[model samples]
Every structure is written in structure tokens, then in C-alpha cells.
Target: MPSLRNYDLFISHAWKYNEEYYALENLLSSADMFKYRNYSVPIHDPVIDPNTKVGQEKLADLIEAQIRPVQCVLVIAGMYAAHRFWIDKEVAIAQSYNKPIIGVIPKGQLRVPESVKFAAHEMVRWNTDSIISAIRSRAL
Candidate 1:
């Protein structure tokens, strides 16, 4: 059964959605008594081209707008190394808005980057229980 409390969350990603992202989605969906709405920007539905300065600003604005209403941000620590540019911007936006960030260490990952750790309010494992617990605790 889904919980009555539905959390709004922004999961950070590069332009392309990866396996980790899908895995996280599945984990959340299958978790007992957990419900959430994802505010992630999908590649199939991009806001704008981030190449130009104007477009970058617009995209940043869009990302900020997505993060503003969310209870917390979920960052895939393994994806950060490859997409630091946009992920960094997302983290900055979340921080500026006082949104809590939950850094999710990817399944089988042993080392998470220091940057991700530093930005996160709480670090959680890939397990659904741990992740849900962190979200419930930190978002408060």
C-alpha cells in the first residue's frame, strides 16, 4: 500500500538517464508504504539547449523551479563524476533554496566522491529502507 504522505523529490542526473536512475525509481516504487513524485528532467523532455549562455540560464531557472517545490533532492553519487557540471548546478540550487539533499551511494559502490558527501545533508545506502528513512528524517 502506498503511504498517504507523498514526497516531492528531485533526482539529479546528467542529460541522459542511466541505469542507476531507473534502479532508484524501481526501488522507490516497490518500497512498502512509500510514495513520491519525481521532478527530474528527462532527456526526452528537455527544457532547452544548455549550450548557449542564454539557454544555460533558462535551463538553470527551470532546474531551480523543479527543485523549489521538492522536499528533498536525491543525488546518485556514482553519476556525479561523469556529470559534475549540471549536477553541481542542481546541488547549488537545492542548497540555495534550503532543500535537504540525500546522497544515495549507488549499489555496489565503495567510494563516493567528497563533493557529493559534502553537499549532502544525509548519506544513505542503495537499500529502499535506508533511502526512505533518510528522506523522511532529513526532509523534516
Candidate 2:
């Protein structure tokens, strides 16, 4: 049995994309939903050796279970997602479920990760204030 929870969004991104992660999470922090317990951040499963196929499958299963209840998957698109297995896997699962997915590109010249763009249902160029506004206003 699953524990019941209420949340309107899930934030997913590659851990390598640390800057984007903090920026986007900061945006969501000001949202009323965040304060009201209507949003969540997906917890990453521990990394296992790449050569362990069974471990990889188990990790994927763990992530899928954690993300299933989320109403939307918000991706912070940074430059390295194509090289990150877990980010790709998470985006694929979210897309397969027809979960609403959005990507916010971090400021400066950071290129949008191909995996992120591929999975994004909507995309935005994030100015700092606009990112906060989008989340706070629930406009994205």
C-alpha cells in the first residue's frame, strides 16, 4: 500500500546541473502551493555501479514509484542532461505517463540539454524574477 500525499508538482533534474537545480527550486519556494504542501522534490536513489544491470533496473523502479503521484514534472534544463542516465530515465518515465513536463533554462549561455528539450512539453527562458513569478503566480 502507498502512503497518500497531495502535491501538484515534481521537480526533476540531473544532480550535475546543480546551479539550475537551486535556481528553479528557489522559484518554486515562493509559490503558495509550496507553502500549502502542494509541491514536491523527487528524491534521487543512490547511484549504483553502471555495470550492474539489475541495480540499474531496481533504481529505475524506485524512481518510477516515487514520481507516479506527481501531477506535473518540472525539469531544470542545463547543459549536461544527455550525459546523465538518471535524468534521462526520469524524463522518459514522466513523458511515458503523459505527465505535464516543463523545462526552465537557467540564465546566461548555458545550453539547453538535449534530453531536457526532448522531454519538455513546454519550455521557458528564465529570467530570475520571471522564474519566481511563474511559480508564485502558477503561470507556467
Q: Pick the candidate with the highest lDDT.
A: 1
Model 1, position 129, has a per-residue lDDT of: 89
Residue by residue across 39-110, what tens digits does model 2's lDDT show?
Answer: 444444466543489888887776687567766677777667667887788888887777867777867746
What clash pairs does model 2 have?
none
For TM-score, the strongest prediction is 1
Number of backbone-clashing residue pairs for each candidate, in the order shown: 0, 0
| lDDT of every predicted structure (CA atoms) | 0.85, 0.65
* Alpha-carbon TM-score of each model against the true structure: 0.89, 0.70
- Give the local distance difference test score of model 1: 0.85
lDDT of 1 by residue, 53-96 (tens): 98889888889989999999999899454447888899999999
The segments of candidate 1 whose C-alpha lies over 4 angstroms from its true place after superposition are 1-3, 44-47
Which ranges of candidate 2 are over 4 A from the true structure?
1-7, 32-51, 127-140
